[model samples]
Target: MNFKGILLFISLGSSFILSFFLYRQWSLTNWFDALFLIGLLLIMVYCVMVLIEGQFFTAFLKSTRNFFAKVNKKDQLIRESEKRSVEPLDYRKEFPNRSSFLQVGLFFCIGSLLISSALHYLN
Candidate 1:
């Protein structure tokens, strides 16, 4: 299978396994609860994946560095030094499959929600 398909399968399988363990060992009480928990977990994963895809951490670091440089009265020097340095690494080129996390997280979230809804309606 392709990377996206593999990611989706792994996410779905892991979510099921995790939810099953929670239902068995914790106070989940039912498959519905477990599925709901899986939905939440997958949603969190989706958000984190989105952040990563957006390069939020990189931007945050850049802003923090600027803030510190400004506080030190060396913003211009820092900017000039950065311009003279080698080009920053292209993360997308380095990790070409990283974007697949967004789709996998989304698919897992939606699947968990749908299953949980069905369980709710059936019971």
Candidate 2:
């Protein structure tokens, strides 16, 4: 319905379509091309999803800053009890209510691709 949902739908559809075409091509030609194209498609979909959501960059920056702050604090040799006092990063706060459907679809596509490839190789 929304932009993210639309992108997810496009990505999932492309994954299925590409997998079908890649399998056909692999049967006729080579496996390397199919594998490369699969990887490329996955990367493209990932980039589009991440950029559209605009959270990856924000999460990365936040994690980096948190890491440095922890490192600096550790250098001060704080007590173990004090170390435990530092609050952990709350991923839920960063990206609340993230959809799992896209992840499930992506993983399903990847799993099918790998299983098919393995079967082909075994044969």
Candidate 3:
């Protein structure tokens, strides 16, 4: 696991515990609020990870600039060399393991909700 993945797991694990408590105390009265709070926490964790790694943020800015440059719709004479050359697309390079972090976080959130529901029923 990368640094981001580790951070995600830690945050999600703690959130799961907190969520369980909220579910027990509030009994679904604040389910949406809890979900929103957890989403914000996850976003904050991602922002911290981005700050620590730094590469993803820089790549995001670079890719945005490239996208705008390509989308300008300006007509220019194509050079022979540029016509012959093709840029390779590797999504992994652009995203930098973001999918895994999302997947793990999503799974943890769902699992926590289920567990909380089960506990509520069992009580």
Best by TM-score: 1
TM-score of model 3 relative to the true fold? 0.36
Which residue pairs in candidate 2 have backbone atoms (N, alpha carbon, C) closer than 3 angstroms, thus clashing? none
TM-score, candidate number 2: 0.29
Per-model TM-score, in order, reads: 0.49, 0.29, 0.36
Residues 21-69 of candidate 3: C-alpha lDDT, one tens digit per residue: 7776544425534654665556555566666565546667667766765
Tens-place lDDT digits, model 1, residues 1-123: 999887666655665677667656543235445544554555566567667767768867666665665677465577677775323544431346655765555555566567767766888
lDDT of model number 1: 0.60
The regions of model 2 sitting more than 4 angstroms off are: 1-43, 51-105
Steric clash pairs (candidate 3): none
Candidates in order have lDDT scores of: 0.60, 0.54, 0.57
Better of 1 and 3 by TM-score: 1
| Top-lDDT candidate index | 1
- Which ten residues in a row are the worst by lDDT in model 1? 85-94
